[model samples]
Target: MKNYIVILLTLITALVSAQSTRKYSNEFMNIGVDAAALGMSNAVVSHTADVNSGYWNPAGLVHLEDNQLSLMHSSYFANIANYNYIGYGMSLDDRSAVGISLIRFGVDDILDTTQLIDDEGNINYDRISTFSTADYGLTFSYARKLPLDGLNFGVNAKIIRRIIGDFASSWGFGLDAGIQFENNSGWKFGIMARDITTTYNAWSIDEEKFEQISGAVDGQNQELPETTEITIPKLEIGMSKKWIFNYDYSLLAAANLNVRFEENNDIFSTSFASINPALGFEFGYTDLVFLRGGVGNFQNERQIDDSENLTFQPNFGVGFKYKGIQIDYAFTDIGDQSAALYSNVFSLKIDFSIFR
Candidate 1:
């Protein structure tokens, strides 16, 4: 009991002392996240498992306990878009593990509109059209724990591509690096850096679109508009501590710090991680079924008093394990403003390991 209290105090101290009141990223980049990350308010970096490691904490790859593969699909913002993921991680030997994951975000059947007027000073027709757009990414990860116990590190590099209704396609690449450590006593720490490169390309813009936007006379439908592609750099650091209250129940707590930079905004700022703290306990009710649950807070621009309804405060989740398989679910938020994103994310996790 004392250990749990100490851990809680330490985490609160870290959050209070480290809170940053600076402004940050623009709307577009601020909203990118997979379902699992969104569920915990993205409180990852220390607890690494499942395929979510590809996005939340690459270093988590070091903890892959089995030769397992997982597939997850999430609907975000009340079905505003679709997010799909597939992850595979396997231990090549006792000393190393390799992982691969693919993520895709798609927006479907969007209304495309065009207003046309007749030369006879009368409104002719309004065109209501639809198109589909998507962004896909592939990441390859490698992790190795040094022979020295408790020292683990990993890295990931990803290829990202964007497609817009056959109008255009562009690709870019980025890298992620992470380091983590866990002591037998339950003290855990980790740091991860992501988006080490400008993630998009200006050169990929269709040249044909440039001529029309420049006011150079061009044929109808032959020219489109051109806009600059913007990508920003994001860095995150986190720490956590857990206490084995007993064999069946344990208390866990964690916190994270994020530093974000935008090239175009000339803005530099920090968001003290929302101080994610959760309590989880496991009970093997019948040696075939296990149950888990907890609560935690989410940092935000407004006061989030309700976590269950996704009004954005503390988060809650449940998980079950059966026959080498585990499935988990969580409810959380995505936007920092009045983005009408008050909803819970659904995440399905499966774990299985076999050595052959």
Candidate 2:
């Protein structure tokens, strides 16, 4: 497992270190927060209506008439790390609602090896240290119904923070906006703009710790690298349709298209070549048990490389609801067999009618 984690870290480092001209940060922000949504390959932008809706499309929160609370925890990458999420939503009035959400991702008990090797080339077990690294984010969301029927708009303000074993830390801020349209015919549409204001992370590194790392690496470099990056805006469009059978069974199909602008060579040469599409389906039996399946990361065939050509990425989930309480489980395929990069998620939610 440790070797697999090392390989995964290498792949992550290579992706982030791609080009000096096109740098980005806080990629973890893109991970899905709700197990139910992630089980649908993050295709819930159009059809979601729960406390966790703020994470997918804040506008969907207006559809929730009752006070709701949600919690989710996941074992990521074969138990190498942990991810958790929590959300609460309450209607402020008949026309507007508010939601709060939090996310925590971390790795605990990491062995610090700065003192493991002695000057005589002997191992020193007592000199090793352990530390934890984590990332946290809090989001406040507000959604209001439009004067027109079945239309809603929302915004999210997010504050993000990251810690690297007490040696390095960063703070960031971002804004997101979304709109949803629904009708009486079980048709829904949604649009969301994530990081519309361009999130920026400013990192502060402990100079002494960095100097110690430099010395341990035999003085390979005299100075540390830059610690600032900006996350560009991403736009998503989603649509969904539902069908009811015999008044006891319901099936819904949804899809989403994501588009983001990226620079060709420099920050100025911008284009919209980054496109990813996802598909999801869900079936509910008497509104008690639900089954879901989804497929995502659908890139163009021309962009497929040798390593990515033979892999499949799909997700599945199941849920049970009883007396306003719900439990959901999701599984995601990571597409890399050698790295064993799969994940499991579990979530719980409760709702109560505000009118009551």
Candidate 3:
């Protein structure tokens, strides 16, 4: 326990002292799925006792003693995009579990413009068209307890697909792995490696059609080239401590540190930089009702002298469970640039252990 405390303090110090860096590709992968997790600022790496753990840290799935299914939907970026997730987990035996998860992020009703003006220099609304963009992923996960009673390990394999209407598409694959350790003293620690295999997206564009419709009239158009983007690896470490107040009340506190390994702004210098640190708390009453809140993105300060940065955000949520059904809702202010850009996320979870 002393060692864990020391490690947690060390990580917190590093998170505050390290310099921030540029981000990587496939940013949608970083978006949190379930409301319960997001409400706590995505600090669930050490406390994933629900089916949604399949998306955060698969090693936490070994803690599930029942079959479970979870679904979530969010109005992201002030309804500019839609995000959804589905996951199911089942215990294979006393110490083994398996799970599957799916993710979708899309923007619909996008205007596909062909030309803004004609040779007569007049606007033509009839010539404008529309198309949508989408991203999808399917993941399979497995987890098991290690020989050490309190240790667990897990791995996930995933397939990724991205589509831009019918003009271009890409397919990619990746792997993730995680480890978790816990004790009867209410201390839990976790580490997760996202995109450990370095996922890639190979884009193919319909250059001929693009050039024919939008190329310069004077024949000075540049050609499009096929390109591939690789998602950099991200590492997260977290710790949580649970405090039980008698039999009907409990409080939990958790913290997480996120670091990404990718090329710097120079595009040639590659290193790991601390991205953001998150802190969260949850309070439960009678095991039926819960309240959650968290603070995240403490690293991206827009101003150095303002003392309070625009990048810092706060999230809050509420949840309840009845029989086999659980419902959750979360709200977060993600708009540092504007106040109208807040978002809401909702999730439903079902546990089938009673049937057995």
Q: Pick the candidate with the highest TM-score.
A: 2
What ranking emerges by TM-score with the best candidate at the front?
A: 2, 3, 1
Tell how far residue 97 is off in model 3, in angstroms.
Answer: 1.1
- The digit string of per-residue lDDT tens for model 1 on 1-356 reads 23432543444344335423322212233333444444444556676654556566666776677766666566766788877777777766766678888778889997643323333546544644567878778889887786668766677887777776645676767666676777788777766666554354432555653433333233344444443343444556666775554465554556665554422211222343322233323334443443333233322332366432222344444556565665656554323423355555455556664223
Task: For residues 1-356, write the lDDT of model 3, one tens digit per residue.
Answer: 34533553454345433423322456777887888888898898987876887889999898888999999998766688999889999999989899999999999989865555677878898877888999999899999988877888888998899888867888888888888888888799988878765677777878866575546557566666446767656778899998888889989899998765443322123343545678999899987999999988653333567654444678898899888789999988654533336888899999997566
Tens digits of per-residue lDDT for model 2, 204-282: 9998887777788764746876788777666777899989999999998999887656533221223533556788998
TM-score of 1: 0.69
Each candidate's number of clashing pairs is 1, 0, 0
In candidate 1, what residue range of length 10 has the lowest lDDT sum? 261-270
Candidate 3 lDDT (Cα, 0 to 1): 0.79
Question: What ranges in model 1 sit over 4 Å off?
Answer: 1-37, 115-129, 203-230, 262-313, 333-340, 354-356
Compare candidates 1 and 3 on lDDT and give the better one: 3
Q: Pairs clashing in candidate 3?
A: none
Clashes of 2: 0
